[model samples]
Target: MFTSDYKYKDYIQEIYKTFSPLSWLLKIFSLDSLSRGNKQKFASSYWALAKGALTFTILAAINLFTIYYKFTWFYVELIISVKYADAVQMIYDLCQYFVDLYFVYKYGSDVFYEYIRQYAYIDGMFGMEYYGSIRRRLINVMIFMISMWFSSSLSDYVIWAIGFGLMSTTFFSMAYIYMFIKILTNLHVTVHIMHIESRLRVLGDLIQECYCSSVSCTARIEDAVIKKNWFYTIKTKTSKSQLYPLKKISYVNSNEVKWLSRCYLLLTEQVNFINRMFGMRPVTAPCWTKGLSQGEGLPIITTLGRRDGYRTRYEKMQAAYKDLLSLVQSQPINFHMAHFMRLDYPLLVSICSVFVTYTIILIQSI
Candidate 1:
């Protein structure tokens, strides 16, 4: 429903068109195919093996040189560079690349693997294809960011890319290298989102099951009790002292009801936590009925609260549960916003503004 403005199928086609051919060569270890979970064989088939081996042999010389330059000679170049700041930047870039590489290899792939599993497992409560679309867009954004690093590396390290008359060979050569960096880093974040959603979905399913089972069992017990009371009235005495019609018509255990209510409240709390994290405005059912009432756990009781009060409590909890489902269905996904947890957009802007201000001061002082 939220994808009305987004053309997912078109973008999926674009991804296939752009990446299908070189996927084998690009994912030397089949990481891309592995990341997709299933139904793709671009990485491990006989043709993929033959083509990847042939291409690696073809690019072996340059690949060797590039790897050595990145891990070793780049740092050595850093110490000798005249512009220390940009040199430091190159160091940071390489470090970010390595750290992101480790994260992607170790957790990112597992995350996507689990994401696909959970998406299918939960029958697609996975929400917006944040796994697919945002990941691609985030990689695009990071590729733009990488351009900054590449430009600095060219000016500072003088190795990653070098210019020629009309075009640069190094620039073309390292395109896949940077693209690899972008994919890994973006997937790292994508996997994290998937993992969290997977856990939340599991918890939600458990709570729903409990709610169903408990409510059904209570209904059966209440039915049996009412029948026994009717038989007693027919067989025995009915006097003014005897309350013959009085039977426990409702056997919804108070503990079970309250526990479910608490579960519902906790579910909403978690949903709001994720919403807050993603910079989404709270899906407030009046901020959880005014935080379960003013200051304490109990609301101030008024005489008007006399009409089927348990039903009102049940309705509130039920609303919270449904709201959690809707929030899950919406799946907040803003790349810049998602990147910063515990800090909303205003705070992020303020931090950036302050940093820029201080940088200007330091530059003027220099």
Candidate 2:
């Protein structure tokens, strides 16, 4: 009932055209397909593969060089001054780059293209005003990304150049490129989820309309009969609720319910797919505090009693350590699955219950 006359292939092409700018950005980083001629071919060609390797190699080289330079020029002084925090932070940032790079390389354009293809198919399943909304959102996102990229790129260079000298600007620029790619990846997934959510809402409205229509039909018939007997003016008061009593009368057919359920299921599966593709380890403030205490504060604490004349510095370090310890102890460490369920015994039980429930549903359907 909700089918559209627009061809699926044509629809996909239109979507691709709308998102060409984003694809172009990914192409510059060698993270997406090289050619725009065939939206179906998501895998990069041999040349694109070589380009990607070269791109990664250059980034790796810059990172390694930056690390070497920092250690050679600033590491000893920072350690002597008890300011090695900067060095540590740089290490963490560089590690994040490598981690993101690994994922980008592993998934590449094929996974993203598949996501788009599946999104288009599901979106087409429900007849909604497709092009106008898609284009508006895509354009807004493109504009935001472009502007953010420019502003961030400029800021990174200025900050690094002032802090670490002009030589380090190139290193930071490479890092920013990877960071931008990661942001784009996340943005794409978020946009898909939003589209899926809209479709699910439409499905809900359709089901509601089905029920409303049934009730309205019954109401109209009652009104017609009452109007026909207009000569019998001696009428007793009758409420609308009395005329339309709630009953176990199925307004929607089983087949219609099945169809709606299938649509809901498809949307849910797509959400799961997006989650799996983009899932990362959740980090909490308590975890970071604990790590900092163990990694950075422990050594300071061990040497506190041994230090001879740095009494004031030792006092400050002791106070900081106390604060860190207190913070860590006060906060409980609990991991949650996207804040939906805690990773505890209860979650395990829920998983088993879900399995049983689905099994029952399968048997009943058969």
Best by lDDT: 2
Per-residue lDDT tens digits for candidate 1, residues 1-366, read: 113223433333333433333334336633344423344313334443354345444444544555455446344643333334433444444444443333333333334344333333222222222234434554575566657666764564344334333123352345445445544434333433443343333333233332333343354444222222232112221111111113422333344334434433444444344333223221111121112121211111111121122243356544544444444334332222222343434766599679979975764454
- Between which residue pairs do clashes occur in model 1? none
Give the lowest summed-lDDT range of ten residues in model 1: 295-304
Clash counts for all predictions: 0, 0
Among all windows of 10 consecutive residues in model 2, the one with the lowest summed lDDT is 282-291
On residues 138-203, what C-alpha lDDT tens digit does candidate 2 reach at each position? 668767876898797888699878987886556446556655765666555445544654454444
Candidate 1: where is the Cα deviation over 4 Å? Answer: 1-82, 124-340, 343-352, 356-366
How high a TM-score does candidate 2 get?
0.56
